[model samples]
Target: MFVLIWATFLLCVCAETGLSQKPRVKIPTLTEGQQATLTCVAPGLCSGSAPEITWTWRGAGGTESYITGSSTSFRTKTLTAFTQRHISTLTFNSSAEHHNTNVTCKIRFTGEKITEGGSTLKVNYVKEVNITGGTNVKEGETLNLTCSVESFPPSLIMWSKLGSDITLHNDTGSATLSIINATTGHSGQYVCTAKHMNNTLQENINITVIYIRTPQIIGNTIIKEGDVLNLTCSVESFPPSLIMWSKLGSDIILHNDTGSATLYIINGTTGHSGQYVCTAKHMNNTLQENINITVMYIRTPQITGNTIIKEGDVLNLTCSVESFPPAVIMWRDLSSKTNSKDTGAYTDLQNDSGSATLVIQNVTAEDSGQYTCTATHPDTTVTSSVSVIVSWFSKIQDVSECVLQAEVLTCVCISEGFPLPTIKWPLLGNHKEYAIKTTVSNHTVNSTVSLKVKNHGNSTVECVSNNEKGEAKKNLMIRSVSDTVADSSVLNVGYLEIIIAFLIGVVLSAVVCCLIKKCSRKKTKNSGNLDETLEMVTSQDDPQVFMFIWLFFFFLHNYKVFNCAQISSLLKYTYLVFWFSI
Candidate 1:
């Protein structure tokens, strides 16, 4: 019975806990500079039941404060004056300063003093904070950094970084720190400190400095004799550093040195060709560096003359010189003395001393002159002049042949020679000697001899050409006209026609003279016998003369007429023969 009673008590306690239990309230999140609201609903309580509500806030330190409560009943909480009534009948509006603060909402029975379950409210804030500008800086460069936090008034701003010094600026809400011409030693972390009454915030930034070196060079790398050499050294620095130069013997002080390190090398020489050191001194420390240099030599050479000649021509010349370290021959004009005519083929023949000979080929008058051969070497130059004398023989060109004719004579002249050969005609028959004309072309020269020839005999025409080398002559034979035309019948026919025409002309002339003389005699006879007219006497001499004249004229006329008739007959026969032949 006692066990049953204990079980009944446990059952009664479980039932009471289950009937009074309420759902756990969910907490709403908030941001900085915004409002937060807390609310609780009693699912077990009916609408007609009057439930009481109370709201309070708890800070980070666990401190609690009464925010609101019902006027009639302390369990019923009233909304704040700034709360919106539309979204919820119970609400509260709070600022960013209350960020992370928790608001608790408790619901209770109207007549019961005990509270039910509650909910929590969380608030968030957006703080505008950033570090502006470059965190890494090179030595000898300006360094600047800024920390900005746009906040409400009465907010304090301070600058600092982790493992760094605290930087403070007054009067401005934003803090900025700047280092002009900074160095590697100025690198560290930076932090910004901002505070208000009973409130404080902080941010951090990192900064690093890079170191660099700059140096300057002076004068020409290549120098001539008696030239003044000047070199200057410089570098970029901060905090002002001392400049000095170390040379062969000792170190020297440099002038005009400010942020830059300047060093000068005066009257440099081969001895100065070694290493040059530049040192920069800042406070008690010094940085040094050295550079190597090599000096170059100076000089230019001159060349003179023509480098060409003809075959079989002797080349006589010399090359003169004037220079230091002696110039070496590099190139030649002719290349080689033999086989120089081959295209693109060249020769390189250098003396043990490095001088070279330039030979060219097939030289005409163009090959005559002096030539210049130059020798080249590093740092110094020398030149030489060669006097080249060329000798060559003239060559023959353009051989031609022609034939001439006069009457029964024929002649052939062979004009084959060079150097413009002279021509002469032999006295033949009754021809007179006259001037000779010469015609010349690129490869050939012609000589024409003007003279007369009357006989059909063997004759020769000659042309001779001469130079420093030797002379050459050309000859041709002449033949008679009859011999030349003996095999042709056309010439014989033409000659016969000429002969017949001549005979006819002579007969006509005789007839005309006879008629004139007869008329004149008749006139004279009439004048002497004017008294009577009758019988006329026939003189025997006149009749005989007339008869002889008539006979002579008839024969001459017949001869001419017969010749013409023969020619016409021959033409008719030739037409018939040609037709038959065809």
Candidate 2:
């Protein structure tokens, strides 16, 4: 009974001692490459002896071993007379390999009492940020990317595209960025940012989205005729799209290029006005766009009328033109040389759809001028003219007479008409040797004929004037040479006197022309003879000679303007009178 009580008392005391002396471990926050200290404290209930403390480690692979490369210190102290404590501190460099590892603190007392405490090790550590995914993706396909880093206590990661303010994804573990139906607009550089403890890290990746845009046509749909038709077709795409321009109904391609194409229709006409299509082909897709073009134009005016109308007849003319827009028509007399529409007092003007008509009642000689019809449209103006001629005949003047001078018969006849009447002498048709001349002014015409006659003629002495409208005739009365001597048609000089004056004038004219030719040749030091008769000098070396030549040509060119049929006749009328007066 005494041994049993002694054993029971010892067991109770040991239980209390064991409960009070359990080893305690204190672990603070740890980081890689930082000096770390782990402390194990024991109760100080036992006052007789100190406790032996040691450290041990268990790795992530479940391997266990005694801790190495660490310094440990043991210290004992008494808080009071009845209380005592022991402390064992272990110091080592913190590393990433220590993360999630198990460390234990063991204490062995003098009475063979063993006690231990432990905690799982934790270290704050993070590596460089990383992004994983393919950077090149097709349009309308999914874009999958992951941003992550190896870290203790898992770092916060975020995914963002460069130049964007919004974060695409964020996570405490791997950050995943998922985009459905990606487009070319989504192409750019992406960044992955990792924040771990006191460190922030970033990594970059480039992505490209390939796609094709809708084809578009650029140009004016409405153009004027004869203007160049310019148009362009283009598309936005990767793997450059092929662009082609073609007319709507034709299979021929007008232009072909990559990404863009230009079509040209030079001097485009009404035939070129139609619909055009722009086609774009990329990868496996085909796109098209169409545009309608119209070419506006107008044609020249056409005039129809009777240009030659008889006197007292009605004149009618019509002007018409073909154009897209109806035209404004006007009838005008071009004689005024003005743009304002002006018609004669006796004229009627009427305008209809695309045409104008002009009518004149009782057309007369004054109406024998150019009459024009003008057609004007907003785009252009066209004009057409017609020459109108009024025909009429008047009788020959009764003053017509025949004179016999030195056995030569001379006759004079005059006629007046519109479309100037033509005079014919049946008497001259029988005589081959005759000099004839005709003069016309306004609506009057004068014809004269001279022939030698020794005796009475077998044919009648008649003058006839006629035209497409009517005819006029007169029989000239023959008179003795002495009786018609005062007639103004011939000079009233004696035959011998007339002959002498003509010879003298011819000699004088010849001498003057020869002297001028000789003088011009001498001035130029030319050896040519005076063979160049009365012709003007063409040499530009002498101003005086040029002036003289100019005047001579002027006179020679103007002499025919008057009724001076022959040089002899002029001298005969004037020189004779001068000689007799002198």
Candidate 3:
């Protein structure tokens, strides 16, 4: 140390002492606002006079001045009589401005040669640690941060993010942390550390990245009837975003919260099916997501048609059901006659979105049966049934008659009609004593009526039959009492034969009389010829005359005709003899 210092001092001397000069000393490092001291000594081997030693100060700008008076004091120590050792010391308060300034010690020898040794002043101090630049950073932009401290010898500065091991910046006096294309993950608290020798200081700054992530909506878009519907919305941001749920075109808020929101629909139906929206609200920014929900349901089936119809009328039926996402419709005839198209009956089926129509044309008895309608959907099926009947007008048949037996006159009238026509007998006007019987076969109806009429002669009995459609009547003539009693001959031949017999008798009588008169008009020869002609006409000898006589007798002997067809010979002979006498 002595040789190094002695060489430094020798370099500063303007003239050679030939002997070793005093050694140079290291400048003291002074902290700001603290007391400091400095010392300089003259060479102990110097000859003569105890050389004068003084201290001067030069600023960093190169301006020089004497360090004077009360800040500087001199002390001397006696060594030997011939050569004496001399020293000087300077004292003052130190600050950061005094750092890097020059201070020098000067000595003037009695030989008129001057030499000096000087050192640069160093002061150690540090102000408080601080961070600069914006605390908030936009996403995808450059993130710049600087940390610094004012201290002599330049304090060590460090930048680091809190809760992390990695250091962002490390330097002297000032440190900057820079990240390009920053993201939301870069938001956190940052720290700046200023380290001075034996003294440490730290500063903290909270950095937040202003950014928003894409919003997400989670749920089922379609829902069944009478089932719960759930939906959720969420987003990530610096300050957690606000999430809200709402239906499109409606202002009512279904759900609202921070960070996330959930929407629920209990027992969802067709009325609740529509578009739903999930929105996330951030600082000066709004994000949204949307979804659609559908509710599936079905209603009961409805049928429309008349149960009873005319025989030839049309039978129309309609089946309808309401549901979401339309359903399929079908028609079926439950009767045995599935092929209704025959027999002038046909079923026409028409289908639409939610309904079905069945048209039965030219309805007949075969068309009268049970019919069913069905509506089918993905979830369920609906059905309805109806009954059909065909009706027709009533009519009477022609085989109606009356009969008589014993003393009691009984009448029977037969008629056939649809819906069982009723038969009524108006014998006199009204008779409650009569009885009526009816029988039915298929669509035909037979009615029989019976009554006793003891004095029913030369009168007419009336029979009337009626039904919903129409009515019919007939009359029967009553015969005489004698004819009803002992009229065997008339009854045997019937009235038709009796009429023919009478007509023949009249014509024959005329011819026979005319011939007899013609013979009588022949005069003389007359008397004898007339007698002969009479005999011939009456005798059955001449065919024309005989036929006339026979027919005449037959007309008067109607009862005889029933008794015997043969004529008695004795009676005929007597008749002839009597005729001859006339």
Candidate 4:
């Protein structure tokens, strides 16, 4: 019983000493390439004597070793100023291999008392940077990128574009880069960087953007007649795009090339006017543009209506042409000089049917000429011609007159008419016996006739004028001179016989005068003697008067026997002689 009690008292005292002294260990977290500290401390409350501190560490691979003052990475210290304490310090350059390592601290007291404490050591370091995600992406889609780093203490990570100084993300952990609705400008290389104390790591990735654009048609689609039809097609894209031009609803390709193409028609016509399409093709993408083409053309002008027109008649003409855009029709007088009349001039009457009419009223001979019809278009012009004809006549003038001299007679007949009228003088008898002359001026004709007379008699002369239209006649009277000359000769002979009887009476009177003179001489003697003498003188005078009368009668008979030409001369001489003697 005594041995059991003594052993129990010693065990109680030892338990009290153990409770007063304990070992402490401190292990601090550190980055790679930085200094690390692990501390082991012996309790100051020790009974009767001070304790000694020791340290040991367990490696990541489950290996264990003691740390002492002589070790290169461990150090120890003892403090006795306030109270007795023992410390063991650990020093080293940290690395990722030191993570999750176990450190132990032991305390040795007097009488062979030992106590130990353990701690876990945490270390921080950066190993490498890795990028995760696809680099190739379509435009307008979301992009996700992850930047991962293998390290201890979780290194700071950041993302940035390669060609610029802009930072996409910056944080103390793994970085994620997200881009919403990316475009072509968002393409190129990107960098992810992992940073730790005195250490940096980087990784790069290339991103590509894909897209397509619609096609376009360039140049004017409206083409003139006989002009070249030109068109071009273009598109914008990467890797170039296929371009083609074709008419709508037709498989035939008008033009085919890359990027841009041109279609040309040598001489465009109305048939070539329609809807055309421009197509641009890329990888699994197609774009099209539609264009409508119009062609303009004109046909030659045609002239119609009356070409031959008579004088004083109405004239009508029409000009027509066919065209797509409608042509301008006009009438022109080719013979402007002949169409100088204001009433029968060319006039324009335009209509919507591509035709024009030219009307002329009361056309005269001056209006006979050629006329032209012209059709004009924007690109070309055409012309046609027509001719007009006219016919007319002139008036007629004086017919016939006559004159006679001595035994010759002359007759002249004149007629003036249009279209050269035929004139005849029937009184001229033979053609050789008469002279004829004709003259013409403008549309008028003049004819003259002359005739000679061989016989003297009362007769009639006539002239006749005829033409294609009608005929006319004129008559004149002519007198004979032979009977008038014979009547004048008889009156002249009777006057000569009266002159002879007067001459005989004149001779008797002269004899009586001589007898009277003798009687007057005797009258002085006596009245009786005068009377007897006058009676004797009268008886004597009777014989003398008888003898004188016989002589006068004989002379007169002799004169009557003379020829008519001679008697006319003798009578004139005898009458002059008798008057002079009286």
Best TM-score goes to which candidate? 3
- lDDT for each residue of candidate 2 in 245-345, tens digit (9 for 90 to 100): 89898999889999999999899898888889999998888999888888867788899888887889998888888765568887777553333445433
Predicted candidate 4 versus true structure: per-residue lDDT over 1-582, tens digit per residue = 986676566555644655575667776767767777777766543223455566677886687874332232333333332223456776777777767777777776676767888877777767778889878777789788999887766778899999788899877768889999988888889999888777788899998776667787877788887789988888877557889999999999988999889888889989899999998887778889999998887777887888776557788888888886778888777566745465767533343347888878888655667777878877677878888764443333544455454544545455544335676677656545444445455444544443445665657667677766567776755533453443332122346455653564466557657666655323334654544333433335357666765665566547755333334444454556556655
| Candidate 3 pairs with clashing backbones | none
1 or 2, greater by lDDT: 2
TM-score of each: 0.29, 0.44, 0.55, 0.47
- Enumerate clash totals for all models, in the order shown: 26, 1, 0, 0
Worst 10 residues of 3 by lDDT: 562-571
Q: Report the Cα lDDT for residue 527, model 2.
A: 68
User: What's the C-alpha lDDT at position 363 in model 1?
Assistant: 49
Off by over 4 Å in 4: 1-163, 174-194, 200-209, 223-227, 267-270, 282-285, 304-318, 322-325, 336-368, 388-582
How far off is residue 342 in model 2, in Å?
22
lDDT of 1: 0.49
Instruction: List CA RMSD, all candidates.
Output: 25.3, 14.4, 22.0, 25.2
Per-residue accuracy of model 3 over 289-356 as CA lDDT, tens digit each = 88888888888888877877777788888888888767787877766354554564534355666888
lDDT scores of the candidates, listed in order: 0.49, 0.77, 0.69, 0.67
Q: Candidate 3: where are CA atoms >4 Å away?
A: 1-26, 29-36, 41-73, 77-86, 91-97, 101-119, 124-130, 133-135, 149-175, 187-207, 219-229, 265-270, 304-314, 334-353, 376-382, 389-582
lDDT of 2 at 110: 74
Give the clash count for model 3: 0
TM-score rank, highest first?
3, 4, 2, 1
